[model samples]
Target: MSSSRSQSIQGTLPVIAALLGNGFIAVLKFVGFFISGSGAMLSEAIHSFADTANQALLMVGIRRSKKKATNEFSYGYGKERFLWALISACGIFFVGAGATIYQGINALIRPQHADVTYIVFTILAISFVIESGTLIVAYRELRKTGGKAKFKKILKNGDPATIAVLYEDGIAVLGVVVAFVSILLTELTGAYYWDAIGSIVIGLMLGVMAIILINKNRALLLGKAIPEEVKDRIIEILEEDPAIESVTDFRSAIMDVGKYRIKCEVEFNGNALAKEMFARGALREEFEEVRNDYQEFIKFCVDYIDRVPRLVGNHIDKIEKRIQEEYPEVVHIDIELN
Candidate 1:
């Protein structure tokens, strides 16, 4: 679109690195948590585990969304991408934020001094670097599709999977920063509650990220309409045809992430159709054959009128083909007489 629009931009980058990085970081975070018994480290571990789960869920969606259309699902399984995204949000809410917050509260109730300072710090340093690397990769891939596109554009029009990768990596990086600060504070101040507070803060961040992801995915899963600019472009394409005088009852909705179904009623110009037939010399030959007899002319006129629907249908097919040439995302088109 020339401007703002809500449509999924489909791609398959930024997933592998984020998935693998999260998986590796999750193991290290758990190791640090068990060794140090710091609430912040434990929270980071849970966050990383949730991220690992997110990768698995995203992979599930990517695979399932590729399934061929079935009788029961005539539109195919494209929405399944958003389906697992929704599920990942739910997982983040419960497993990531919920567990982290609970652990924070538990640590607050029963505070414990952390141990193995150097090892815990080393783990956090590595986690931060890994998460940041994943974030950078995700951003680079985003630029490939977005290319100076603002965050608003990506949020409104990006593929859910890519969005998940970028957003999750971002939150992961922030979570690691919070974890590092909290642990460092605990080490300097000897107050275990600082670690607990860090845990709670990380949980809050995940909660917010989860909510945003849930809402975005829900809109997509429910077949959100394409942007107004997109609709106007299609309409303009239709009206550009001389045979189409006007358009009415235009409607479009997502069939898959990037694909759409468009339906509309078009007012065809009878004179234009006749002119087209004249240009083809089909009507001139018929008129020449019937000019001698009034009865034969009436029969010919009746036959010509009877085939008007087929004539209009042929022109519509051509228009549809042109539309496909102009906008390939328009996979399904339904043009009706107005």
Candidate 2:
């Protein structure tokens, strides 16, 4: 299969896995909640449901992002994933965090003894194992893209769909732990508020992550620039070429997860470019033969002048090609002569 198609499929793997895992865990949690009337278990159920929906939305975003480019959207549909990720973030805030917190508060107001017994433990254990398994899948997928770099750096530049799943799965694992502790406390002290507290904590965790995802997606949608140090490296590459004097007025923006475009004004080293493209020994010999004949010399000068622009154009193409080779993510490059 083609690389892009393979990449697109790879992008969805974590989301798809999370979706299935959460869907199953949601069912398990609901069953546990019904039997034991545990608010924490109910909250986890709701969280899983929200995650399932959010993963589905991410899948939509990934699919739509693969849409072919058009005149109306010249940069292609890469940002489509960011738009969907923002929507998913809002879902986490409202549907996930909102409902979870509201449930916790409602449970707190009317606390009740819950007989989770040992069955709830079994359910939570299963759920925890599944959630952890999904989280591992996400981590492995991220490591594939991120290599040996720190996870923070990877997430800083990772795909939004995959990153969102990673965050959600992490929260899921933590939520299970909190639920386990709250249920244990409930069994120990005969106080139900601990269960409510666990729910609230889980909700707060989701809220924090949701807000972060929202802000992150918003920035990416607005075409956030790549890191300055990376941009500096790109600039350095351009100026290192002898035909180019310096690069200025540089600008860049991410077009997608791992793709971006750059624009800059370039100052050419005129004498160096002239010598590289035009000052050939064969040309010098030809010029010497034509110097004594007025018509021939005039023709030579005219032909030389005519070829200059084409040669310059070719050189510019070469420079641009080299820049792309150095930074493949620079899918588009615009250079203005200064």
Candidate 3:
């Protein structure tokens, strides 16, 4: 398969896995909640349901982001991924975290004993295993793109689909642990408020994670630039050409998950232009008399000026090709002469 196709598949795998896992786990959590009457279990059930829906939204983003460019959106639908991710973040905060917190506070005010403790423990253990598996899949995909970067850096710079799955699954696993501990503590001490406290903790964790995701997506939607190292590498490539004296300025923006639009201003070698004019038999000395004649000089100057842009354009093309070969993520490039 092509690299893009491979990347697309890799990106989709986490969402699909999360959707399936959360759907199954949500049902188990609901059943466990009904059996044990545990506040933590109920919160977990709601969290799993929210996770399933969030995975669906991510899948939509991934598919829509692949849409072909139209006249109205010449950059294509890449930013749709970030938009949908932001929506998903809000969903987690409101539906998952908000509901959980409210339920926890209500339970704390009116405590209720939880029975069937064994069932809740079993379900949480199973959920933990399943969530761990999903997290492993996300981490593997992240590693493919993240190289040696730390986990927080990966979450910041990685693709939205993978990042969403990683965050959701990681939080899910931690939620399961909290739920398990809360149930165990409540059963041992006969204090039902522990379960409510666990629910509150899980809600707070999800809230923090949602905020992080929201900020990352917002930055991308606002046209975050590619990494500084990447920009520097591109500049290095452009300056490698002898015809380019210096790269005066460089700027880039992320157009999609793995694509960018780069604009650069480069100063061309003055001697190179002089050499070209000499090679074309347009030496200034040859045109000395022509320069004295206003009409002839004007015509000659117009032709020379016309040829300069073409030569500069050809040099820019070479530089663009080199950058593209070095970094396939750069899909659009605009080079201006300085």
TM-score of each: 0.92, 0.94, 0.90
State the lDDT of candidate 1 residue by residue for 193-232, as single tens digits: 9999999999999999999999998988777887677889
- CA deviation > 4 Å runs, candidate 2: 1-6, 285-289, 295-304
- In model 3, where is the ten-residue run with the lowest total lDDT? 2-11
Give the Å error, residue 277, model 1. 2.9
Give the per-residue Cα lDDT of candidate 2 at 286.
Answer: 80
lDDT of 2 by residue, 223-287 (tens): 89986777999889889888788886899898876678889998987788867646564477886
- Every candidate's lDDT: 0.84, 0.88, 0.89
lDDT by residue (tens digit), candidate 3, 277-329: 57878665748869679898888878877777777677678778888888887
- lDDT, candidate 3, equals 0.89
Candidate 1 lDDT: 0.84
Pull out the clashing pairs in model 2: none
Look at candidate 1 and tell me the lDDT of residue 140.
72
